[model samples]
Target: MSSAQYARIKLGNQDKISFLSNLGTLLAAGIPLLDAVGSLLEDSKGGQKKVMETLRADLMQGKRIYASLSRFPRAFDKITVNLIRAAEEAGTLEVTLKDLRDHLQQEIEFNDKVRFALLYPLIILFVFIGVMLMMLVLVVPKLTTVFYQLGVTLPLSTRILIFASDLLIKKTFYVIGVGGALAFISYFIYSHKKSFVLNILFSLPLISQLVRQIDLARLSRSLYLLLSSGLPITVALELSAQVVMREQTAKMINRSREMVLSGKKLSEGFRTSKKSLPTIMTRLIEAGEKSGSLDKSFQEISNFLSYQVANSLKTITVLVEPVMLVGIGLAVGTMMMAIIGPIYGLVGQVKFR
Candidate 1:
């Protein structure tokens, strides 16, 4: 049977990879494909069950699994379709699904690592802000009332603090309004103008490098999976682009595909592009071309980019922690000085009297 004969099937949820892996195993172990799908459907829950039932119905209609999968673009995606096509062509659907599962697992692990690295810093920043705001808006004002009642001549710093606290308390409504407006504006910009702004921002030095590495990692992994499944280069690039989250990276890949179609070498196309593909990535692409093992080259590039991203995240975490701590310390220390300095000066004056 030609690889294209398999019906299109869309799998959703975090459990999708696991389900596919199990189904592949069952099929490989002499279970009929339909029965295996039925078993999966029976075991499924939530959106997964809905997807399986839809696939099962489509299968009964004599549609290919890949075609059925196309109905749910969100779940299956182009990469999934291309991989299925390649697997079908190579007569290794089960093995391809297993490999896809492993690839997805690695991606999940990498994402979790990034989240773990950021979580502590985020929590610390939140707590620091909360404590500082509490001290400034709530605690300092109550303490300042004591010095005021004693008829003390407050220092410039303490006067500044009192003024700020009074202003914040009196203009609290304006503060809330301004904060809400700024948040709304930020949300609007993020939702509407994100693409252009994000592209510009991601082009900046260290941050741009990190973002580019992440995009390269995802691009290389998707390309590797598609190419390894025996897909054509152009087709694989097209499919891989679909999985790329960054619009800029996707655009670069699409442009590269166009260049390839125009008879330019793939590596040269990417190398000549203004897009931020790393030199190492271009070299790997060239090596893949020379070795006729583009799939392996893509995998190697993915590994390199993944390692770079992990290291970058760790560096960012380490750098941000000390910077945030210093900022919090300075802010808190300044506030404390503002409050205590005036009180100490008042006590010294009374002693002199």
Candidate 2:
């Protein structure tokens, strides 16, 4: 829970989206910029309040909103800064912020939907583990002592269960310490070796697809926003690359930007990088290039990728439920047989005696 709090402090997607939405509303209402920011600062709560206060101070010092936000890279990611910069340059900051807020809200809702879908399975898993641990540490040892007093010779499985239960009861602290150490080491490695972690993440099959779609959605959205605001294609591509979360995807986009700068067509660059793009996206880009509607095409691509990712997440959640149920059933069944099978055999032997 403390980790979750720290994560929220680091500018979670939901927090930024909420802030952007409120800011957009304030801006759209014709409020003065500094006054609106000051009001927001006063209303802000939790970890984000400090960020808002700092931003307001910077605004008072003659810095633009986007530039002020740039000072807090943890709070305002590159994509956010690029969108705000585009909006300011186009004299449509309010409109752009509203769009960005909408995009961020959609992403947050999509993530929530995924989490909601997985909630039941997660609950079941947690309950199963808790029950199993209690049975192992509390019930098993007592049953073993009873069997010993009754002069009953335990079966191999029962002996194994008793040994495991004893070990768990005796070494629980050691196990917990090791687990904590491993968790800390994992976090340290993940934070310091981002490229390595990202590469390994992208190598997974289903997760790789999901990540690619997410990257494409972000790239297309950022590119659309920049291009529609009249940024040059080269600059839009470069900024979009910075906005991409995946290192591999960013590298691909950078290469595509280079191709565009070298006189290659946008469609050609996309077509050549099909691994980083969907076939539908390639076709849409080609058509947009021919029709001079690249901005609209990018928007359509963003929407399509967003839909795909949402559906994929739903599919994954649906698939995980039955699989988790089966796993829990197997674990319980195995434990019950280990405990009950010998009891039935003992009853038969007592009847014979």
Candidate 3:
């Protein structure tokens, strides 16, 4: 691959996990790092192949592994780089690699669960919209002509349906163009104004709570890994801050890091900042500090927060399913009433012949 292609080639989670697991196993078995990376070339393909080749080349040139990994920011984030660097410095590469693989696997599974939980509601909404649009364009106009031909007053619901059907059929291109433009604009704003969008999300009830728990879970998990790998507390906090998505949570972590550097206890910093942190986390950290097992405390906190996030996702899925079903039922009932109400009125006016 060319330099530009190499720069653009980002590996997926599974690829990184496989790379770490294999490399760690080889190193544990007393294989040299350079030879292990070279051996991985037998199975590597595409971007992963490029990555392994580059790493082997870097190692041959006497550059550190972490330095080579830092070149691929998209594939290896800052947190991964720092952890590996710490491992290399402290002679714990095998252990850190194993931890990294397990961490990545957990992250992937949790992300998949969250995505699957939300997918059902989105599918239902899109299906409902598609069915409604088909009825408006294909079915409503035909029934509207019959209602007007009866020479009797139509109900308000029928009139509204006719108006909508006429608009869709007559201004189809205009509607489509406007809709496409709006969708593009919405996507642009959502991408470029993430903090603004997050602010809106934070104002929501269920969504805000879910967002908080997910970010906390990520932060705690990252801190646990970084601290357990022999990283300094402030450095661990700083790296953990980058792993969370919420702007507020990241700022709070950064503030906590500053406080830790100023000689305050980590839990004291967390408790004092308290911008977006929960009391439970601070309390756990305090207890962990007193017992001289802060890393273990973060591990427990991560587990608890992850469980809460999973349960919250399940609860949301359950609640949204019934609400969306009732919404679809209401929409269908209105459409049925509009179409059938006029026919019932027309039948009553006819005399027996």
Looking at model 1, the pairs that clash are: 3-88, 3-89, 6-65, 7-64, 7-65, 7-66, 8-64, 8-65, 8-66, 9-65
Tens digits of per-residue lDDT, candidate 2, 2-38, equal 3333334467776787788888899889998888888
**Per-model TM values vs. the true structure:** 0.87, 0.87, 0.93
Ranking by lDDT: 3, 2, 1
In angstroms, how far off is 303's CA in candidate 1?
Answer: 1.3
lDDT (0-100) at residue 84 of candidate 1?
74
Off by over 4 Å in 3: 1-7, 149-152, 273-275, 351-353
1 or 3, which is superior by lDDT? 3
Ten residues in a row with the worst lDDT in model 1? Answer: 1-10
Candidate 3, residue 65: lDDT: 92
Pick by lDDT: 2 or 3, better one: 3
TM-score leaderboard ranking: 3, 2, 1
State the lDDT of candidate 3 residue by residue for 1-353, as single tens digits. 56566568899988999999999999999999999999998899988998888899999999999998888888999989999999999998999999999999999998998999999999999999999999998998887787778775798988998888888889989889999999999999999997898789787988888998999999889988998999999889877887777787888888888888989898877887675677888899999999989999999999999899999999999899999999899999999998898888888777532
Superposed by TM-score, candidate 3 places the C-alpha of residue 227 at a distance from the truth, in angstroms, of 0.5
* Residue range with the least summed lDDT across 10 consecutive positions in model 2: 1-10
lDDT by residue (tens digit), candidate 1, 1-353: 12333323334447778677887899789887678889998888765776778778878887767776666665667777667766776778789888878887887887788789889988988998788678778887887888878888887878888887887788999888999999999899888998877887787766777777788898899888888888888998887787665687888899899998998889977987645787888998999999999899999999998999999988988888898889888988988898888778788988999
